[model samples]
Target: MDAQTGSTASAFPPGFPWGGAIAANHAEGAYLTDGKRLDISDGFPRGIKHEYDAVIDPKKCYPTHEAIDFYHRYPEDLALMREMNFRAFRTSINWSRIFPNGDDDEPNEVGLQFYDSLFDEMRSRGMEPVVTLSHYETPIHLVG
Candidate 1:
């Protein structure tokens, strides 16, 4: 009997954890602002994968430069996240954004301030922030 045969149908419990995420090299666009500079990500070309050298040219479109412009639009973006009922928003912190050249004696003040505001916005909207420290946005100089 259909009523007699019963089993759990869902994989997770109700109100299960759910969220959205983006890496620093994928969504942020403040690569040159606030005492920032090139990271390894700046070398990758847009659209498709290719040899690193082939896409390193500057004549072609760069993905990070206009990557959703999240660096500037995060407040609005976070608001949208709240609308989606996101339990947490995960995004990486561009290493270069915090410490330009990856060897500066002091961290960039503007860069530090940006994150303070970002996290505040998230908490204010009842959304938790999950930040990544160096997800492929490592300063290029450090690598070289």
Candidate 2:
């Protein structure tokens, strides 16, 4: 409701581009699957609140490690988005997914394929993808 007029807004404008957004480190799991390797986010069990773990702890849970399993379940997830009339989606390319070690001479083929399939799937569903090159999760190999 508008404070001045005490009227409620009808709805968003047509073609307003309803959609969703996700960061790779926050959505995609499979941190070590395919040719992928550890990223800066891999060691942080509690996000940025505490210092990053020197090594991954078996007993500690890292949210990113299995976050919604988006890596393997994107088709299902995208279908849900399509059902909601989504016309756009914002997501990131995991830096380590492409360059597993962050300094590899060549990009990982499997990783490249995954994103290719993901983008293609999004387009197939009539959703325009807005991609972020990275989302602060640098490859762990490059951090140390």
Which candidate leads in TM-score?
2
For residue 2, give model 1's deviation from the true position in Å.
Answer: 11
lDDT of each: 0.82, 0.92
Instruction: Spell out the clash pairs found in candidate 2.
Output: none
User: Which window of 10 residues has the lowest lDDT sum in candidate 2?
Assistant: 45-54
Model 1 ranges with Cα > 4 A deviation: 1-8, 53-57
RMSD after CA superposition, every candidate? 3.0, 2.8
Candidate 2 Cα errors over 4 Å, as ranges: 1-7
Listed in order, each prediction's TM-score against the native is 0.85, 0.91
Candidate 1 per-residue lDDT over residues 1-113, each given as its tens digit: 23556755545567765789989778878668878878988877767586354235767778887788888999889888889988888888888998989999999999999
